[model samples]
Target chain A: MIENRPFLKFIEHLVLILGVLVVAFPLWMTFVAATHDAARMGQVPLPVLPGPHFFRNLDVVLNEGLWGGDGSGVGYMLVNSMIMALLIAFGKIVISLTSAFAIVYFRFPFRMGFFWLIFITLMLPVEVRILPTYEVVAKLGMLDNYWGLTVPLIASATATFMFRQVFLTIPDELLEAARIDGAGPFRFFKDILVPMSRTNIAALFVILFIYGWNQYLWPLLVTTDQSMYTIVMQIGRMLEGAEEAPQWHLIMMTALLSVIPPVLVVLFMQKLFVQGLTETEK
Target chain B: MASVTLDNIQKTYPNGFKAIHGVDVEVKDGEFLVLVGPSGCGKSTLLRMVAGLETVTDGSLKIGEREVNNVEPSKRDIAMVFQNYALYPHMSVYANMAYGLKIMGLGKAEIDERVKNAASILELTEEQLERKPRELSGGQRQRVAMGRAIVRKPSVFLFDEPLSNLDAKLRVQMRVEIKRLQESLGITSIYVTHDQVEAMTLGHRLMVLNGGNVEQLGTPLELYEKPASLFVAQFIGSPAMNIVDTKMHENGNEVTIAQNVSLALGGGRLKDRAGQALKLGVRPEHLVISEEGANTLPLIVTLVEHLGADTLIHGHFGDDKTDLTVRCSGTQSVKVGEKLPITASLDHIHLFDPATEKRIEF
Candidate 1:
């Protein structure tokens, strides 16, 4: 039994390593492809070594236009993605904070029943409502605009649920202390609730950023003009226009670039995210 | 300083549980009052109602001739130190103390001045003031809570079991500190606690509550020497009062316990209500190991507790099913299974009806 245990453990480690590579293969391949030119890309078994074209291909993305210089460039799409992700994160955070605070702390009418309704929205998948959501946005003539991109998902159930639990975990004594300090509801939220919940906000910011950044289906369905397309949509168009045999190098690079910033953000705020969930003991 | 008056105060929980039944209480200007009770009593709910945190449900609560029932907590001019010491964890001790003053639009200089003065009064160093609450010990957080309340300089101070969260030794120390602070400021303060010793030592007047009702309200000595009901008699003393069973006799002292333990209470006004069941209560301290006294009962010793200044003897009467407690002065040599003749002075004996558990009229 003892002799076979080490071999069994070796098999377990191999499985774990294989599992990690499987999940991260595309991301790893993107970075690998970013360094290689179109010639090195088709080599059998792939080029595992780094090439010098890292910044060269980056400049291609930075300088050259996508779809044969049809519109602005990938830079425009990158900027648009940044704007959409940040606005969605910021806007969703504010709405969640105010709504969650009111729902959790205040004695408003039907507060629990209303929260149950908000919870139900979480179960309604975005795909189920896409048709009606598109029609509403179209009727409002908000297509191909930043609001069209950001506003539909701004009223979020996930952010609200996260914040509601966070706010509920704050001791009521803190609120009473603030009140005794001459603070009103507005001041109490700004001064006490917001600052006390910074960890949760940081965690939720990463979650919302990833949610908005990886949004390809909605952005593709909503906008036709490439001028206002998000980074994901730009990547999609870049792959689609490759004529029979796609540019695996550029497609993989674009996809890898899409995942990097959010990965960095999640890694940076990972401790805060776990802390937010574990702060129930407080 | 402010005087607080509650006329016909009532609090009925939404679940139809009446927490504070119609209670009328008055706190003299600059007087410290303590509302004390066991858990599930309405002491905290009462304090919150006074602070405008809880909706009163019913009553007229006036602070300094101002009807404060409808007033916001801030406009009510009162500061509260919570049991958890609720100092802002995110802010430094300085910010926690100064946040109120800043909101009041006090000048930055004045805010700094008040916060510093309060910090010094609390013995919080300048370096401590700049540090966040998480860095402070439990006692330090409690002091910071007081500092925050102090900086406001409100007319009244409400403490909701403020020292209950501290360790045993720290609670006693902080309790004394709070009393001294209140004396120096002479603020009309209402303190709520389940600790009877805290109420006895700190309050100028004490209100004992039970089951959402003010059982008795009087000065500490008054409640100690003369509780208005059976509950207060048992609630006031450290070891509960031993209420031996008795039967009332006509016109004179005709009450007697088991084992022919009988005494003619010199002047029981309840002489008119005779031949009915009655209660004779005496505190453990008053139930001494007597050499000779009018009302005497023999007891069987069960346990002995030596508390330095005194020895507490757990015993029971001859034929009664209930146990008895006798508190003798200083540490004395007493053992289990030893019998002692215990008696209570007439003046110290408390009388109540067994059925209603209400004290007989004097």
Candidate 2:
């Protein structure tokens, strides 16, 4: 279908330009809301210019919204969410990479069965098994605990699959060279394999980081206390409590703050992501 | 220095596919042996077995005084240069050269010294040492791969079609360079290549493998001048040795093409079971341009590939002989459709029993 007059030329560029603006509009609107109060934010056309309420809104967010009014009281929930997401991302990447390496490089019994099992998980979304997972987490005494938030979603099948695909393309010669150079499994990985796989690792880092930060259902079910709630879980509570009338400005501002980390990660790692993917294929 | 001995090496894949049979080749200390064959000939598989990359299905592999069949490649003290250069693309030339040394926990100064020495010998300038493989040309990447192998000072070196990836001119240059390097270092090396010219030039002794069996093992000139079988004779030369169907007649001599076009042979008659269907094998350069003498065959030239130094005349041997290629010096100006009688010295002719497609027993 893309064979003739492919959408990679002048016309496509124009469409792409419009596409960028379309995506950026909501994000820009979030930033604009962060600068204004509820009145100006909820208007028909939406605020697009600088306003005096930017610092004022920040004061409100930090004061009553995030830190609970007292200057000394920084609700510890923010730190909890930050730790949960960071640890989950880190844990997921480590597990995925190691498992991926094993699945791709080693020849052992039941290898094909294990690989297919992991691959089948990729097609089954986390939403399908969320209730059963939550029941298991409750029985393990993991409710309102960090383990509950991170453990269930820590093993990312997609990242493992991606890493397996990446590692498969690595020249067998490289591994043989390492072997000849007196490098054992660990040394080979540290000195050669990991360095060659920078791009793949970088790509997986972004994927796992985004997946962790965007986690809503698992964290929502596991954390009963506000102190253990993640940013996404907090967003869910905030939107739910609004009932009939919502504080769109405060919600938008919180969302903008939540999105900043992942967006920044993607922007900074884009070069690495592209480079790693290309090198893996090469 | 080490002597590598492969005793009854066999390779069978997961699907019950036996790629290599009971193959045996012993390489002496400081020897340069090349495993040469056509594609799918299992030559590379045999070399990988010696390198400990392929598992020995039934036999034993010993390096130096140790049985390396179950040993890891690292502990075996071997260095391999791959067909694609396989120079760590991320590493600079200096790092590529020094990697094995650095990983072995050599001192920084020692690693630098060895790298510098290899670079100097390879004629890589200081500026070139800082560049990555992508930045370097094909020839330079190949040199860097060599430098990496050289710095290891391993007991044995393994080369797997290292020159196959280079252009023709670069391949020629690298072939001589590798031979000279191997000679100067006097390291025991096993080189694998399908290019017979490379096998001839670089090897001290050549092992010609087919269907996983060693068809012949001898000095390059031995394999060239006296190929053990019809396979070896046809495989070891360019334009391939002209293999034509002939017949074994009464007495010890065999008639080639017909009685008037007969070729004399020293090998006695074989029973039909001996596959006595006679075949004539002659190198292009051995054929004389005119048919005045015995052992000469007249041919109508179909095409002439004039390559300055030599001209290859593609022709037919008889109405029955479909394809025959003759090689002569460039001085001859024989046109296509012109009949030329080429005389071959009786001693230079190789006789093959067509039924088995093997060289006759003399």
**Winning model by DockQ:** 1
For candidate 1, the docking band is: medium
B8-85, model 1: which lDDT tens digit per residue?
A: 899987899888888898899999999999999888999999998888888799999999988989999999999999
User: Which 10 consecutive residues of model 1 chain A have the lowest summed lDDT?
Assistant: A64-73
Q: lDDT of model 2 at residue A126? A: 66
C-alpha lDDT of all candidate models, in order: 0.85, 0.81
In angstroms and one decimal each, the interface RMSD of every candidate reads 0.9, 1.3
Tens-digit per-residue lDDT, A130-174, candidate 1: 999999999999899999998988888888988888887889998
Which candidate leads in lDDT?
1
Error of 1 at B111 (Å): 0.9
What TM-score does each of the candidates earn? 0.93, 0.91
Please report, as a residue range, the 10-residue window in candidate 2 chain B with the lowest summed lDDT: B267-276
User: Candidate 2, which CAPRI tier?
Assistant: medium
